[model samples]
Target: MGYKLSRRQFGQLVLAGTVVSGFSYLTNKALAQTPNLNIVGIGSTSIPTDPTAIPEVKTTESYSTHQSSVTTDIPPVGLELVLRSFTTGSTQVIADNGTPLLEPNEILSGFTSLRDGTLVVAITPLITSRRKATPNRLTFLGASSAKTLIVSGLNENQQLGSLLGTNDGRLIGLVGSKNGVPPITLVDINLKTGAISPLSQITIPKDKRVSNLAECPDGKFYTSLLGFHGETSLVQLGSNQEKPIVLAQLKVDGQEWNNGLQNLVCSGTGQLLAFGAMRYQTPNAVYSIDKKSGNMTRLENFDVTQIALVPG
Candidate 1:
């Protein structure tokens, strides 16, 4: 339930519900279309952004605003899917033991899973609009209603957005800067013991803030693409001794760049999926990225409101 992002970075997109301008710019791409990966033509994705309407795939399009984000996945319980909304809403969880836990005025932002399959939800407690000074809260929910996460003291600062769990179940939150200047700083948290630590301490590169976070199957640090000016680049967390590596660069390809990666989450297994669209454009279609090949391909028949990864 802990997060890396301080309140400063979390200001950009509040959950998947309220999306802002385009983020992530590719390094370069005069020629489009990458090779050596699989490319299957799925249908098309359409958002309500344009006056003209069409299918979701096949035609390169644009998108803005998403209703939810896919953060983490626990095999049998479904991907840790989150629904977004400008207003506060509540959801109920029925633990395996059939204990009822009521979550109120909460924003379901991100998720992370432990090595043993326990799930940690990166959530910010819902405060009434009247309560503007409320600090963000992180809670841990066990896979079997073990117990929710508990943190001692929280300063009014520090808002968290996306989250990714380590192979050993350590939680990392994409933090926002609370003070002046550009927001969005990366930070990590230990869910098991509620420890707050700086991810940058582990050698993560800083710059051009992260819009989303997802773990690759290889047990790499983690990856999330950034977009701006019609271009995109996939940034990954590297070893403590190295810098954050840009796996798939932000480059323009034949006038097309993969812009705006909305929600990204990886199954403890090898599957990585993200939903987004062309830069500066309401919701786009879902995309399945090949973590191994740096391939951003389309995935059809996804429920934007609820996306869960089912092992094949």
Candidate 2:
């Protein structure tokens, strides 16, 4: 159920992952000119936003059948509710500028910032963003409170994007076993001192695949390389490291174009925002990376299912 590319078949899988890393792009303004990485456009949720105050809306899906119903079963394209701060009247900002830290039934898979504003939601399950939604492993919550002792450990098929941490709060993600076959990993967790780290082990030897992930700002953890020979890498892990250093790579996809990349934000200084998922209505790309000339740029064309840095 993965191989749905149509932005002209992802521009021919980004021109065959760029002619196997010849490093090119004379289009997206030569990749956003690099640096601050801007390519804005917040919410569309397929269009028909506000939906008049956002109440359940008769159990969901009823903005007049979502504009005109193209239906890819869409329903995780928006929502980052938690106001009283980054005000803009009635904002949405689903990954363009920043907006994420939701914890009511948990959807955000990564984001950190402590103190006055308090937010550390790696709590999973919005249909499957990896982990915490199995035999009900005490799904992190507040009202009917569940993260009581904070023990939900079963990062099944972890594609845990937003690439864990180290900007004062680390919790990197991605770890698989059962369904995501052959070993696909890259983990780290310290959801505020719950400590448990282990980075990089990816063992996909026979038609590869991996998603977007980021953890930069000195302590690197960037990822790319999606299915059947895909590659667009950058991974770094230290502190008595157990191995994880690919420096940079944007070459690896030559076997009938399998398409890759999917949400891996890390902006605000280090600059990196990977989010490319094609197929169906096809429209999601937000590269904008440059960890020091590895170069990549392309933001705002939205379809983004995740990536939040919320702060006007």
Candidate 3:
């Protein structure tokens, strides 16, 4: 069954995941510390220099007027690209020589970098109507002006999930199951034609849905599964494997990660980085996952929805 949220909850939360690479544009200080290794994400807070630092609570402002104010659904905000350094704990926006890559009335659903460092992002137009259907467009961003691509071959109800850039330089994405079924499928995204080709279906439990996708150096793919009742799991699968192997039930400080995790990316050093999206009673943060043990170490208090790694 599909999970539904209220309008207020929809405004407060965003589905997170993105494929990221290329850090040649960061500051010299960040480069000197981590070299080619950097992290980019969509969030409200910057990466903390101290891992133990708690995120400060943010209060909402209130406005009062004499006339009657109409209430409406809060539209999703366009998330900005924030560059982060894991080693140095520094953060900045990804810009073209100090010029920001900001777009109006667009929500970033997913993104990945081409081999030449071109960023391909999946954008959904900002809309307030819950009944209106909005298709996602693929956009290329770099030194030049932004170019939009029309993505074809998806049904009216299908939506793209997290994006992944293969080691062989191929762009891959996850497509939710059609007919509201289980086992999401992997698809190859043709950058030139903006067409999607189905590869294989990921075998998971009936009540579970994939949140993000990542590929490691060993050629194996990893993903996080969100259960019906706040259950989360990390699984590894490959072409030769008959079925996905459960690595661990995701946990932090001996407590279950019920809020779930997304934006899974393999770091330059083969480490897995993920963004834990915020939910009621759960804090949004970044964490490093141990593939062998399924243990998680919180890296910072940033409220990131999606994240990617820049290779040196």
Candidate 4:
């Protein structure tokens, strides 16, 4: 027969266990909220301090402007939805399969497709008020009765970086400086009410400015840090960390290490890829970056001007 306990004894035992378990649960919750800011460099590729030191890699793919068929279904495996901006101040959403989604009149700096198929766009102004920065606007397009304004008042000093869609109908974006300044602010945008709230902010180390920022699948943010001395490294930002954590130095041979990097996209494959266009008229290459080690793997060369990835 199983051992039986007295009524009072059983009650006391249950209470003790509950108290212990509750403490353990609260401890884990606190630890989870804290971010580890340790730098983890994996590859032996020495991070170059000189901007002139570019990684040497042969071009494996060519740029093309062909569009594939559009579908209402979720993008297929190995393919993602993309937003391509033109020099004429026009923006169009295209799938990795080459399907055209939408074109708008305003210049879109960042965009994200929500879980409910709603499209949230960041309208980046071409002109900035040098005297004082003004708020950028967020517009809602498609999946609604008509185009609507969602939120405004993004960071004015910093041009808006890539926007990442969240599972809860919210969006995350970076307000990064164009002149290599510090204090890149991470903000949250609501799709329903268009409210904007800053979750956290981190400044880069001296001589380093963020080129592009993307949301990793694990809820952390990452960016490509361009050094004033001509070096570039990938770094991660945690909500609890006050400073950015360096992941790995990027290898950009023959590519402009400065503002040439654009359209940083976090993919479902747990990597970030972007168009590394050194300058106009130069063949651009797509490179994939590992979030953990900051290592970059060149994918293929393509000609699209600016490409945004579909949110995973």
Q: How does residue 267 of candidate 2 score in lDDT? A: 52
- Residue 90 of model 1 has an lDDT of 31
TM-scores for the candidates: 0.53, 0.27, 0.68, 0.53
**TM-score of predicted structure 2:** 0.27
**Candidate 1 lDDT over residue span 1-312, tens digit each:** 312222233231122222111111111131122211111111111233444533223213123322222232111111121222111223221112222122323334555445543444454543334334333545443322445554323444445656666655566767653321234566766555555666664444454545566665676655554544435566666675677777675322234445655466564344555665655443455555654456666543232321222111
lDDT score of model 2? Answer: 0.38
Q: Candidate 4, residues 40-159: lDDT per residue as tens digits?
A: 000001122355544322221111223222122211112222222221233232222222122211234665555443445565433322322234566543322334454555443345
| Candidate with the greatest lDDT versus the true structure | 3
List the global CA lDDT of all models: 0.42, 0.38, 0.56, 0.44
Please, what are the lDDT tens digits per residue for candidate 3 over residues 86-195? 44555554322222222322345676655555556776533334444356678675444457677788765466657887878888887763222445677889878889
- Clash count, one per candidate: 41, 8, 1, 7
Residue 298, model 4: lDDT of: 59
**Model 2 clash tally?**
8
Tell me which residue pairs clash in candidate 4.
51-230, 54-252, 54-253, 55-252, 55-253, 63-303, 68-98
List runs of model 1 lying over 4 Å from the truth: 1-106, 125-129, 132-135, 150-155, 178-185, 249-259, 267-271, 277-285, 290-295, 304-312
What is the lDDT for 26 in model 1?
A: 14
